[model samples]
Target: MTRLFNDPTAFADELIDGFVAAHPGHVRPVRGGVVRATRCTSDTVALVIGGGSGHYPAFGGLVGPGIAHGAAMGNLFASPSTQQIVSVARAASNGGGILLSYGNYAGDVLNFDAAEAQLNAEGIPTRTVRVTDDIASAPASEKHRRRGIAGDLTVFKVAGAAAEAGYVLDEVVRVAELANERTRSFGVAFTGCTLPGASEPLFTVPEGRMALGLGIHGEPGIGETDIPSADGLAQLFVEELLAELPEGVASPKGRRVALVLNGLGSVKYEELYVVYGCIARRLQEAGVTIVEPEVGEFCTSFDMAGVSLTLFWLDTELELFWRAGADTPGFRKGLVSPRPRVSAESGVQKKPSSEAVMVPASEESRAAAPRIVAAVDAIAAVIDAHVEELGRIDAVAGDGDHGIGMQRGATAARAAAHAAVEAGAGAGSVLLRAADAWSDRAGGTSGALWGVMLRALGTRIGDEDAPDAHAIAEGAADALAGIRSYGKAEVGDKTMVDAIVPFVETLVARVIDGEQLGDAWDAAAAAATAAAAATADLLPRVGRARPHAEKSLGTPDAGAHSFGLIATAVAATLTRKDFAR
Candidate 1:
């Protein structure tokens, strides 16, 4: 449990501030995250790695020479916004291209890929190599679908080393991909981790039992078993990994591998050593040759009592990179030469935000701004009332941050909408402000999707004219299209798309049939509600929940459920006489 904190909402930001203050020599704070303080060559490829903020050494600590050049940190258990990634990449780039890497989670992939595309458009070459190394997350036949765990280190290390070796951008990306393919990890937890201000752990293991295949984000394990001895656990890890060696590797006998016995937060150094001692003996007995075996916290959950084993099978080239020296805030290897330190320029200028465009509007549309503000407030209130229940549902198969993320996004959007209305903004302008606020504060898949929806809807509702029933329907259509374009989730993927698609289709049909705005919205809300409930029968095929698809059965997706709830609540608000005015 997390005991020390100011406001829970400000934890991540404050932690970053203090971390940078404490380690100025190793890291310097940038707009998005921390970057290496040590200067790099003018034409060296920058390795920018990241995910959520809870994973400490994994991201920020790994920023230095021979490691990640920068890390785009997000809120706890959430992927960084595309803007954040872009900011970090811009801060780290030095003429050479940028190579982005992270665990292969849906949010990470979507955000990073968007950032990569944006950088390329800006004439800065960029590439991405997602790490999918958790053997327990997917079968050998579908290894590409696996979620990365502790093995994130293997890919990050190899990629950074390749970049340090002055390999071109393409070769650096190739080495990172190869490292990802060779690495495999499995994790187990004796206890669950609790986020700040949360009353309970996201999930728990029963007394005398252990959870298997647990995620680093407080997500519950896929299976449970009786607790095993240190030696038993080590043997289990070795056997499980060796059972499915990478293609062309018949056996581990005489093959050199880099081994990482990582402690997932609460587990102490002594415990890791105990486990690693057994692991070492077992590997030697199995005819496996281990090189550069590391035992400590390389990645972590906030305070999970767990451990993970990563096997990075090494070829000759990989072996040389694996043995290379690294100097970083969290990790140090071999001898490193002292280098001159640097920092982000204090006078650096920021670019205009996407919403900086000045939109023209009519008095009629401007008059409708108050209604949009009211709708935003209504949505936020409903989300506030259901935060806990939504979190509970999400915990079944995903990191249980959906509720908090929504709450933060809704709060931010409400504030932004109110400010826009007070400033005499039109409906479209209010919606656009709210959209940016939601995405910026929320920082997750939900945040990103909600932002896209709001922005698309705002664009269609153009400030120049009052939005009629047809205009509203078109806005909904645009929102749905934006979601599909970025999220890539179809109707049956068990995401908010399931509810939103039906809502848009139904509303569009009703409006075309001559129904009024309020009536059409009520009908659409009902359709969304029904579709959301139907998600209980679906198995997730995307996002963080996909790996635990079976566990999500019989429960509606939290995002879909929330969409239905918000749509219904907004319908009631829209039916008010004040809104009709």
Candidate 2:
């Protein structure tokens, strides 16, 4: 449980500020995250690594010489926004191409892939290699879908070292992919972690029991069993990893592997050492040679009492890179030669201005702008009221941050809409600005999808005139199209798409039948509400919940629930005197 915090929402930002102040020699603050304080050769590829903020040392702390050159840190348990990733990558780039790597969670994949595409379009070459090392998350045939865990270090280290050694971006990507292919991890938790300001843990194991196949994002484990002895746990880890060797490894015997016995927060280092002792003996007896075994917290949940074991089967090239020197805030190996500090004027780049050139609006459109602002405000209010419940629902099978993420996005959207309205922007412009702010501030799968939805609708409802029922319905249809295209989730996938699809279809049908805007919206909102409730009977087929699909059987997806709530609130806003047809 995180006890000390002024505001839970501000924890990630405050910690980054303090972290930069404490490690000035290792890292410098940038707009989205941190970059190495030291200078690098112009030809050296920049390795940009990151994910959510809770995993200390994983992201920001690894920004230095032979680790990540920069880290695009995001909000607690949320992926960094695409804008943040680009900002950090630009700051870290030194003429050489950039390599982006991170855990293979859904949010991280979406944002990082977007950033990679954006950077390439901007003429800054960039590529990505998602780390998929948690064997428990997926079957061997579907290894590409596995979640990254402690094995993130092995991939990051190899890629960072390759970049530091002046490998080209393509070469860096190759070795990183190889490292990811060879790595495997498994974990178990005695208890779940509680996020800041939360009264209870996200998920809990019964007394005298432990959860198996735990995720680092406070997601509940896949299964539960009686707590095992230290030696018993060690044997369990070794056997699980040994059962499925990487391709080309005929057997575990005679293999030289880099082992990481990672403590997931509240688990003590001494406890890890106790387990590692037995693990080491077991491996030695099996004729396996362990190299550079690390025993401590690498990636962690906030305060989860758990441990994970990672086996990085090292080929000769990987072994050399694995032993390479690194000088980062959280990790160091051998000795790195001193490098000059980056010039004060260099590194961090100015953020692009959010203000767009305002197109003149008709009197009717200007008059309708206030209603749009009100709708955004209503969204914020609804999310704020239901945040706790949303988090609880999400904790059933996913990280319990959906509520916080939606609150951040809606609050930011509300503020941005107000600012746009004050600047004399019309309805479309206000929504466009709000869309950008929501995505930039929220920084996750939900955030990205919301941005897509809002932008699509805003574009369709141009500033030339006040939108009628037909136009609003068309815009909503466009939003639905954009969301489906961007998120790649369908109606039966148990995502927000389930609710969104029905809402858009109903709204379009009602408007086509000549219903007024308010009446049509009310009907659509009701459809969405029913669809959201119906999601409880359907298992999640995508995103973080897929690994623990059974646990989510009785709980509706938080995204779908929140979307339903927002649609209902927006219907109320449309029925107000200012927005009435």
Candidate 3:
């Protein structure tokens, strides 16, 4: 459990600040995350790697000479926003192209892909390689769907080494993909982790039981069994990894591999060494050779009593890169030549926020802005009230951070909306500013989708006039379109899309039938509520919950449920006589 923190919501930011302060010579703080304090060669490809913040050393700690050039740190258990990723990439670029890499979670993929496209459009060459190395998340045939775990270290190490060797962006991406394809990891946990300010752990293992194939984001394991001995656990890891060797490797015999025994927080160095001793003997008995075996915390979930073993099958080229010199705060290998420090004045500049500008609008549009602010405030209040329940539901299958993410987003949105209204902005501008704030603060799949929804609706409801019932309905429809296009989740996927689809359909139909905005919204909110409840019976076909689909059989998706709650709250706000359309 995380015992020390000023505020749970600000933990990630605060930790990053401390990390930079501690490693002043190695890294400097950027707008989105941390970058190498030392300058790199102009022709070297920039390797930007990141994900949710709980996995330390993994992201921010890996920024240095032979590893990551920059890291786009997100909030705890949440992917960084697209804007955040772009900021890090822009700061890291040194004439050479950028290579974005991270775990293959849905949110990371969505945000990183968007950042890649945006960078390319802006004439900055960029590409991405999502690390999908967790063997337990998906079957061998569907390895592409697997989520990244402790194996993230191997991919990042290889890519960073290649970039340090002055490889081009295309070559760096190629090696990183190869590294990902060659790596496989399996994990087990004896206990669950608790988030800051949370009363309970995300999930718990029964007294003497252990969870098998657990995730790094505090997600519960897919299977459970009685706790095994140190030797037994090592044998299990070796057997599981050897059973599914990468495409090229026919068998473990006569092959060399880089082994990483990763401690997923709370597991001491002595415990890891004990497990590694048995693992070493087992691999040697199997006629396999191990190189550069690492036994410590490489990536972690905060205070989770678990361990993961990663097998990186090495070829000649991979072996060379694996043994290469690198220097970073968390990881150090061989010797790296010291480079000159980056000048403070030459560091990356913070990008201007969208909310800083106030667009002109008609009196009617400005008059409606207060109602938007009120609705956002109501949303924050409702989310605050149900944060625990939402976290509990999400813990059934997901990482159990949906409630925290929604709280951050809603609170930020409410503040932004109020500021926009005070600035005499129109309803559209208020929504737009709030959307940016939500996405920037929340930093996850839900945050990204909500930003898309609000941005689309706000764009449709320009600042020229007050929005009518038909116009509002049209805006909702546009929001639906944007969410579907951006997230690629359909109605039955057991995501927020399920509730959003019904709400938009009901709202559009009611408005078409000459209903007032308030009445139409009430109907839409009710429809969303029913649809959200219905999602409990559907299996998740996408996102992190898909792997543990059966566990969530009787629980509604956190995203859908939270959307329903927000819609209901907004409906109540719209029905108020003081809220003029």
What TM-score do all the candidates reach, one by one?
A: 0.96, 0.98, 0.98
Residue-wise C-alpha lDDT for candidate 3, range 501-549, written one tens digit per residue: 9999999998888788898899999999999999999999999999999
Q: How far is candidate 2 from the true structure (C-alpha RMSD, Å)?
A: 1.3
RMSD (CA, Å), each prediction = 2.1, 1.3, 1.4
Better of 1 and 3 by TM-score: 3
Off by over 4 Å in 2: 347-354, 576-581
Full candidate order by lDDT, most accurate first: 3, 2, 1
**Candidate scoring better on TM-score of 1 and 2:** 2
**Backbone clashes in each candidate structure, one number apiece?**
0, 0, 0
Model 2 lowest lDDT segment of ten: 572-581
The residue-by-residue lDDT of candidate 2 on 1-581, one tens digit each, is: 88988888788889999999999999998888999999999978999999999999888988998989999999989999998999999999988899999999999988999999999999999999999999999999999899999999999999999998889999999999999999999999999999898999999999999999999999888888899999999999999999999998999889999999999899998888999999999999888999998899889888999999999999999999999999999998988999999888875753564567777887888888998999999999999999899999999999999989998899999999999888888888888999999998899899999998898888888798887777788999999999888888998999999999999999999878878889889999999999999999999999999999999998898899999999999998886233333
Each prediction's whole-model lDDT (CA):
0.88, 0.91, 0.92
Give candidate 1 regions above 4 Å deviation.
343-357, 576-581
| Cα deviation of 102, candidate 3, in Å | 0.3
lDDT measured at residue 304 in model 3 versus the true structure, 0 to 100: 96
